[model samples]
Target: MLASFDIGALGHSFWALTISGLTYGSIYALVAVGYTLVYGVLRLINFAHSEIFMLGMFGQYAALMMFGFAPQGDAYDMGVAQTLMYLGLAMIGGMVVSGAAAVGLERVAYRPLRRRGAPALVFLITAIGASFVLQEFVHFVLPKLTNNTLGGLNAQQPIRLVSPSTQFTIFGATVTNVDIAIVVSALALAFATDRFINGTKFGRGIRSVAQDPVTATLMGVSRERVIMLTFLIGGVLAGAAALLYTLRVPNGIIYNGGFILGIKAFCAAVLGGIGNLRGALLGGLLLGVMEMYGQTVFGNEWRDVVAFVVLVLVLMFRPTGILGESLGRARA
Candidate 1:
């Protein structure tokens, strides 16, 4: 047990928790970058992002359930190539499903009200309410589709992905197949997003519209398309993050787990400066590293306090966040 406080304990804690913090921070930064992107262009919090993450988890789980229910449920049926194919399919499917859900929510729930000239307050509440509605909708639909009273499948079952006897040592740490998969997948996403945003017409449009909606409109940039695409891309990223999170936790997906992580990502966005893409990455990494060590030193009970403390300090020193962009600033 940790004795309230000990100055001499700090050094030991720092050494032990350094690696832990970096790993956790990388994930945090990746997720926060999603929030920064959506908010940078739209200026709306997208309160439902956490729920979108939750949706991704459910979607992936549903896909996995379907696979398990098939006759080839046994791992034996999958050769090396086939296993890779299934993973790719599952992740892509989950992301697509989540992106579609976000798009649908924006169109059906948020767009109509915005079109009617609703107050920002009304918009904010609507966003929050929309999150609840989505959560309820998922809960309502899952049981009907799966017919498994206890959340469709047994998530507690030990996950045996690559092989039973597959483990490697890296820097005195055991690296499992799952870890390799997560690192590779996250890197792939990072690379893809970099290319898509900087090398594509759609990305050009997104930036143009973000800079000046009226001018972008005059230049033939469709605000609607940009907004829609933003939501879609954000949804996809959140979906991918959800998959990574589950692999890390391994205890199965909880319906509301997204809220906390969502908030953390949002904080990360704010830390890096909301509109700055690279800043989100940096802030998330810093936050994750700080949080890891804080928990190690102070125990799990103060993890949140540590996160908030970092936020407060960052805000105090750099109110515009690490990227020097203010998330709360008015756009349009």
Candidate 2:
């Protein structure tokens, strides 16, 4: 194992891997926010959140189709302005679909349970079941609904809006336009979310509910409204991330595509402190960088192993996570 370790490879590709890692980390951070927000408010893991991400992929694809951009073997040659307009439209479609689905999920699957005072275990099981149901619906039912024009066992033929071309070079790493777009867009969204959470009346309500729901309700905060808002915000972010992810990996929009990525996002939430927003971002970047480096040094097969190993170590030594701050108690 020592002989097989390729420290030199890591050394040579350090900057390239870092850029790649940060790009992926941005996506992970966005998805992880969904997990953290739900956990902070409801104390539920929301195992189905990943499926939300998956649905967002299809949502964006559908949006592109609506704009007369059909799935094809190669990217269309739409000029810069037209491409941006369609991309923005697709993102909006994704956000709307994902946000609606998340709200509906809460209404259909969770609200009744909440009313019945279901146990945490029951919620967990339901979340897992919901995950499978969503996956199979796309796998089996979506094709039927669309007359096999979309959603089946195979990945959607990619509708590449942006072909990654080298835009700049930094420290021997070539950065592509897609990389820049993904990172910058993710950061802007994250910053906006942070500001909204820490600087708005509804944010205060969310925090109050997370800290003490019974007291917050007594104080005139509508707990149900806060919960719905949390789900909506998280889902919208996931939808944005889904579009960015497709930009990076054009062929990644499959019915079950979000499973592994969703698990990684969940791990990111746990690694950064399950309820802490900033922690989720930090953990995702770190995890992405570490995974890239590990893949370089220990071979591609060890990439996932590194993420899990890091999670296990964190749990063993610092279960509270890196930041160790809960969302409710976090100061502005």
lDDT of 2 by residue, 1-332 (tens): 53369999999989999999999999999999999999999999999999999999999999999888878888778888999999899999888888888888898889999999999999999999999999999999999999997789999999998889999999989999999999999989988988888999999999899999999999999999999999999999999999999999989999899999999999998999998998888888888888899888888888788888988898898988888758899594
- TM-score of each model, paired residue for residue: 0.85, 0.98
Deviation from truth (RMSD, Å), model 1: 4.0
Runs in model 1 with CA error above 4 Å? 1-3, 6-16, 69-79, 149-171, 326-332
Clashing pairs in model 1, backbone N/Cα/C closer than 3 A: 272-323
Choose the strongest candidate by lDDT. Answer: 2
Tens-digit per-residue lDDT, 1-332, candidate 1: 56455445556556435545555566666677677777767777777887888788776656665677231222344688977766666677669877888788789877897789787777678778988777666556665665643233334232333443336754555656665666567666756875666668987777777777788899998988988998888888777876676666645465566778878888888888886666777787788878877766677778877898999999999998976763223221
The list of candidate 2 runs beyond 4 A from truth reads: 1-3, 330-332
